[model samples]
Target: MRKRILGALFSYSVIGLITLGLIEGILQLVQLQSIRSIEIARKLYQLSSREEYLGRYCHSYIWKSNFIQAYGQHREDFLSSSGLHVPHKTRGWTTKPNVTVEVGEKQYTTNNRGHRSQKDYQEDERKYSVLIVGDSYTFGSDADDSYAWTNLLQQKDERLQVINLAVGGYGIDQMYVTLKEEIDSYNPDLVMVAYISDDVFRLKYDFRDYKKPTLQVKGGNLEIENTPIGGIEETHQEIKAELQKEDIAILKLDDLLFNLKISCRYPPYSLFSKVMGQMQLLAWEESAQFLAVYLASGAEVEEKSHESRGEEVFQRWAEENEIETLNTRPYFLQGSGYQGGHYQQAEATIVSDTVYDKIMDLESWKKFVETNR
Candidate 1:
């Protein structure tokens, strides 16, 4: 009787294993994978009464680390002693000069002083110069250096020289500071401040990894915070420490499958989500300052209107200072062919054409260039 019972137990165990394998196979065939399972589990967990335990383990840092390790890159390669960018005393970071960064099969080289252009500029050059300041769009983050709007404009009119002092992830405050610092040296006949609506939202975050400074309005003045953050290594270490106590080890199989499927996967809209999250975090402080500045100017501050408010304030300041500015807000509103986020070749062409039109329309700009040249 004991022998028979032991044999029966072994048979039942084998049957259970086979059934489990069949269910997993069925799940795979039906396009329901581990990620879907996890999503469903998360929803069920949320519906439960055990709030504290769920909250503690829900957003595991280990999971985020594993996700990045699977889908993201080690930023150390792009930033370190041998990296593209170097620490700047005033700008927080700037690209290393005369370095050729290979992206895919193509290569992009920076000119002397680290600007992303083939031609180098001298203060004494006998050319009609236009100084451009803004963010990634102006820096040609998407299109090639040859295809960048600034480059297109240069191609269209060889007589006009364009100096782009734009950097990726720059806010309006940084543009203002860059123009103030570089305009005298470059001696550009016309200055263009190119901006997108997102620049207004960027004013809120310190963006520690980039070591970017932020602005806060105090006593009706824009105060610049030039301090750098701890850096990316410190952030990684902090995250690792937070997840050390949890049993959140990544499996080899998961990592392999993630890499296999990564090409088809869409990157998360983390930046937009981050902006929204940070907006909630900074609403009170920014709103108070926004209210004070607007009220002082005899302008009414409508509730939930600070995004446009921030932009309008800067626009007014630029106008008052007699600065030439080009706003790309309307173009973005109309939409472009760019995938993910940055502008494509066609969009860059549009920008180049629009800017050319604006400059030609400005009689003072035309006079300055013609007279100076």
Candidate 2:
């Protein structure tokens, strides 16, 4: 009887261990399937390659172009220092410059001359030179000088000599200051301030790097802050700290896998896209909020957003001042709302392609330039 009882206990123990193993196998299979569900055409990064991304993680630069890294900010795969992306060839007419153009303190090399590359553009004073001002879009990141909307605008109408005064990571106050300094040098015919919504909160983040005159509103009038440049150093230090955090990749396997799928997967919009957007909104609240706040401040603070931060300040100023600005939010939609400030990732970007192209269209660019001029 004793022998039989001992044998029964051993048998039960073996079955329990087998059950646990089976459970673990089932869970791993479910996770694998969950990952496999992504279906989309993979895209390649236009500038950097995957091997470059792996190298970048180990602390190395990927592309030779300065604009490539600047544009890659915010969105990981869309603009990451990492090179895990489908190659996107630069559009024709947007080739590397055979010449260089200087804006602010930075110099950009451009292939402005087809086969004939000029050394530099010394503002031909006689021509009606119109400089288009904004942020990265105006500068044309991850793209050549010609690919910039300003360049595309120039191609549409030969009458306009459009110079892009857009810089990556610049806010409205900075832009306004840049304009104040540059206008004297370039003497643009007209300034079409494409004030992005994201420019609003930059003061709170990189307030130190902000050297422009502080702007204030008193009874519907705009006032420059006139704050000393001495105040900006502290803000620059904070910004540097934030920039340093980019190197830390302390994320979970599932989190990393999901992002990898989204980064590699093009056309994030699909039957399952809404679900993905929901997840992203949950994960990226800080980014979204920052965009909302800065975009509002980018415009003249005299105005207020009806919960729409940027529109209240800048849009109102544009309408009242006739800045020839184009706000693409009405024709566009993204979860909470669609305005130029929010960063579109994965499927949201794919979904917004039409709106983006419409804004980027030769005809549309021509219209914006013509109106602003």
Indicate which candidate wins on TM-score. Answer: 1
Worst 10 residues of 2 by lDDT: 84-93
Poorest lDDT segment (10 consecutive residues) of candidate 1: 289-298
lDDT of 1 by residue, 1-373 (tens): 9999999999999999898666545434333234445765444333321222334323222233553353336434224523566655455556677777766654555778677677776564466677777677777775677777778887887667788777766765566556556655655556666665556545544442244655555564455685543445554464456445533233322222333343233222332233223322232222210000111001111222334544565455545443334554454445533443565577677678778777776654557667865
User: Clashes per prediction?
Assistant: 0, 28
Quote the positional error of residue 23 for candidate 2 in Å.
Answer: 46
* Candidate 1 C-alpha error for residue 260, in Å: 38
- Per-residue C-alpha lDDT of model 2 across residues 1-373, encoded as one tens digit per residue: 9999999999999998898666544434434434435432011121122332334231111221222334335323222221211121111012233545454543445433211112244566444455444565445544443344445555554454556555554555555555554455554444445545545544322222122334444664444464443322343353345445542333223233433533453221121122222222322332210011112222222223335444545444444432224454433333343233323232123223432343354343455557766
TM-score of each: 0.56, 0.38
Candidate 1 segments whose C-alpha is farther than 4 A from its true place: 1-82, 226-340, 369-373
TM-score of 1: 0.56
Each model's C-alpha lDDT?
0.53, 0.38
Off by over 4 Å in 2: 1-119, 205-307, 318-324, 330-373
What is candidate 2's TM-score against the reference?
0.38
